[model samples]
Every structure is written in structure tokens, then in C-alpha cells.
Target: MAGWIWRTAIGLAAIIAAGVASAQTFPAKAVHIFVPYPPGGGVDVLTRTLADVVSKNWGQSIVVENRPGAGGVIASQAIATAAPDGYTLIMVASGHATNPFLYPKLPYDTFTDFSPISLLASSPNVLLVRSDSPFKTVADIITAAKTKPGGLSYGHAGNGTSTHLAGALLNSLARIDLNAIPYKGGAPAINDLLGGQIPMSFNNGPESVGQLQAGTVRALAVTTATRAPFLPNVPSMSETVPDYDTEVWWGLLGPGGMPADLVAKISGDFVAALNTDAVKERLGKLGAIPIGSAPAAFVAKIRADYDKWEPIIKAAGMKAE
Candidate 1:
């Protein structure tokens, strides 16, 4: 019995020591970050920006792969099934929390199959129209919609995306009936908005910033309760529709069962990158505010957001189609 106990203790110590050593030298090879959206969206841009900085610091190449489809489900499932090693990760947006409610069955559990690393940043979705459009303010759109029920149409990235939910929330809160037009992604929706195919669109900051800055598109209101600093002149939707608030956020996650120590190390590194002046400025230009919450806090946020949006999603009858 004494000999057996001694052997078990030694084996456990070796295992722990190996984990520590591995974490200390993590990312000896390239790290791949799977992005659910196609390249050039807010999530993709943020992930690439952080990857560039983090890769430099870690002395390892960080590759961002775009796996856009089914409203982020493709990349999410891929990450959920990836090895628990820290090399593989996924950059998720606000859609991650609401996907469970949108789809009847997911290939992997949102909370169980992945470990939350950090809540990187957030930005408001803006209600934009072409500069030549007749609508000048949030009231114009609502009044027009109220006057003609489903006549006025707005496009979003996809059903159940933050942009979609923002439009739905506006419809519900303001008692309007603007028809929602779903597109494959934000880019196409913006294209239609610019081409006069759609009168308006709920676009993320990164998607609309260039147009807004170039005087091609007009931002009537942002979805958040407060005006986005990047678009200070634009009003918040809440100013017209009471209590209205919707913002998209991004975060990093790895497959579940990653060593706690490694999780901490990665979270710390990413958080550090987010706090740097250069990163903050770059994200600011894109209308994203750096968050960088602790891993536990990020986990709590995912749970809270999931709970908060489930009823909204169900009430809206949102689904992946």
C-alpha cells in the first residue's frame, strides 16, 4: 500500500510539471485563429489586429482563417472540436451567445465545449442610409415604416446576428413594421444599401465607418444607449426609442479542458495587447472599444448574454434559414 501511494503521488506531480512546462513554452509553432465571419468584417479585422501584435510578442505566426457560414456555426463547431491545446482558438462575436437560441440543435454546447478566454472589445451597430436617401433621422424611418407597414425594408448581415437583433429590437420597441432583409454578410447588405436596392441597413462600425467618413452613407443613429464616440454627432436609438440598446462584442475562446494556467497566460497576453496604445487607437478608429475582461468575467458575460438574448430571440422567432 505504501509503495502504491508513493508511485501515484510521483505520477501526479510529473503530470502537473509537464503541464507547467508546456504552458511556459506554448505556441512553439503557429497558432491558428478561426474567425466565424469572412475577412474584412469587424470581428475579422479585430482578430487580425490582435493576432499581428500577439504573434510579434510571442514570436510565433498567428494565422486567421475565415470560416463564414450559417451565422458562425461552422467556425464555432470547428473550434469546439479542436484539440485542447492553446494553439487553436476562435474569435467570436455577439452572435455566439445567441446562436443556441437561433438554432434548434448545435453541434457543440456553447458553454461546455469551449473555454472563455477574454472579452476583447465591443462596438455599436449603426443605422445607416445612403447620403442621398430621404430619411434623415431615426424618426423618419419609424414614421415611414408606421405609415406603410412593411413597405420600408432594412437589410442585416443575417438572421439572429447582432445587426438583425438590433433592427428587430427597434421594430418591437418603436412599434414599427419595417421588413427585414437578410443577406449573406454585412458587405453584401452594405452593397445593396449603397446601390439603392435597400433603403437602410444595420451595419457594424467597421462596415460603415469608411462610408460614413467618406460622406457616402449617413448614420442616423447608433444602437447603443449612448452615442458611439467614433460617431459622436450621430444620435443613439434610445434617444428616440426609450431604453433601446444593442451592441456587438468580440471575444476569444478555445476548446474546453485547456489547462487553467495556459488559459490565464493567453488571456493575460491578449488583454495586454488590447490595452496597448496602438491597438486601442486602431480599434477606436474602427469604433470598437477595448474591454479585455478576465477569463472568469468573460464566462459570466457569455452566460448572462445567452440568458438575456434567448427570450428576445424566441420572441422575435429568429432562426437560421
Candidate 2:
């Protein structure tokens, strides 16, 4: 019995020691982080900024690859099937949570195929209209829509995107039927708004800032529980309609089945990078708030967001385009 107990203890110690060693020596080579959007978008820029800082600190190169297609599924599948090593990671946007509901068939399991590392940042989607438009606030839009249900229309980037979800949530919470016009992307949607083709738009901060600064568009409100720091003067939708909150968020993830020790180490490194002044300043200019949540917290966030949007997507019949 003593011999057997001793052998069992030795085996357990070996396993723990191996995990520790792997965590400590990780990234001996370059690491790759896949971005689901094309280069120059918010997700790509954010990923590259963080990767630059993290790679310097670790003395290893972090390569960012953009695999934009099918609303991030192609890139997501890359991470889902990659080896469980920490080297293979992905920077996913809010679509990561809602994709499962939007697409009937996905090559990878949304929740089980990848391990969430940390929620890096979140940005509000602004409710925008032309500077000279009659609608001045959320209440005005709601009243107008209620008076002539489905008479008013708003444009968004695409179906199942955070911007689209923002409009859908407003419609549900406010109990008004505003026509939702889907655009190929936010840029064209904003172009139409400026050209008087669309009355209003639900656009992210990065895309809206240029027009807002140019005095061509006015922000009615932001889609968040609280006012965005970048747009402090604008009210949050929640203030007008209780419990209305949605934002564009991005997070880091690796293939499932990663070692707990390695996961902790990688998450800690990214979180530390997110805390640095350099990262905070850069992201702030882009209208993003750094979160740097723990692994468990990130997991909870992903699941919560998934649950929150699933019913809304289903009821609206939103599908990937």
C-alpha cells in the first residue's frame, strides 16, 4: 500500500510540474493571432496594437493574420482547429458570441471548440442622424415610430452585427417598429446617411467619429448602459429605455483543451499589456474601453452575451449574409 501511494504521488507531481514548465517556457517561437476582419478595421487595428506591445515584452514575434470572410467564421474555424498550444490564438469581435444564433451551420462549436482568454475591449455603437435631421433624441424617434409604426428606417452594417443588434434591441425595448435597412458595410451606410438616403444609422464609434467631427452627422445616443467617455454629451439608450444595452466588444481566444496553467499565463500576459499606458491611450483614441477580464470572467461574459442575443436574433430571424 505504501509503495502504491508513493507511486501515485510521484505521477501527480510529474503532471503538475509539466504544466508549470510549459507555461513558463511558452512562446519560445513566434505566436500567431488571427483576425477575423480585413486589415484596417477596428478588430484588426486593436489586435495589432496589443500584439506589438505583448510581443516586445515577451521577446517573441506575434504575427497577425487577417482571414476575413463569412462574418468571421473562417477565422474562427482556424482557431478552433489549431493545436491547443498558446501560440495559436484569435482576436474575435462581438460577432463571436452571436454567430451561433445567426448561422444555422458552423464548422466549429461556438462554446466548446475554443477557450476564451480575455475580453480585451468594448466600444459603443452610436445612434447617428444628419445634423439637420428633425429627430433630436431617442424619445423623438420612438414617438415618431409609434405614431407611424414602420414609417421610419435606420441603416446598419449587416445582419447579426453588433450595430444591427443595437437597432433590433432598441426596437424591442422601445416597442416601436422602425424599418432596419441592412448595408454592405458601415462605411456605405454612413455615406447614405450623409447623402440623405437613410434617415439614421447604428454605427460604431470609430466609423462615426470622422463624420461627427466634420459636422455632417449628429449622435443621438450610444448603445450602452452608460454614456461613452468619448461621446460624453450623448446619452445612453438605457437611460431612455431601461435594460437596453449592447456594445461592440473584442476578445482573445485559443483552441480548446489548453492547459489551465498555460491559459492563466497567456491571459495574464495579455491583461498586463492591456493595462499599459500605451495600449490604453491607443485604444481610447479608437473609442474602446479596455476590460482585461480574467479567464473565468471572459468565459462568463461570452456565455452571457450569447444567451442575451440568441432570442433576439431568433425572433428577428437575423441570419448571416
lDDT score, candidate 1, position 155: 97
TM-score of candidate 2 against the unseen true structure: 0.95
lDDT of 2: 0.92
The top-ranked prediction according to TM-score is: 2
Q: What is the C-alpha RMSD of each candidate to the true structure, in Å?
A: 1.9, 2.0
lDDT per residue (tens digit) for residues 1-321 in model 2: 999999999999998898788899998999999998888889998999999999999999999999998899999998999998898899999899889888889999998999889998999999999999999999999999999999999999998899999999998889989899999889999999989998999999888877888999999999999999999999999999999999999999999988898999999999999999999998888889999998899899889999999889998888899
Which residue runs of candidate 2 sit more than 4 Å off their true CA positions? 1-15
In order of listing, the candidates' clash counts read 0, 0
Give each model's whole-structure lDDT.
Answer: 0.92, 0.92
TM-score of model number 1: 0.93
Per-residue lDDT of model 1, residues 1-321, tens digit only: 999999999999997887787789997999999998777878888999999999999999999999988888999999989998899999999889989988889999999999999999999999999999999999999899988999999999888988999998898889888789999888899999999999999999888889898898999999999999899999999999998998999999999988888899999999999999999999999999899999999999889889878887888788897
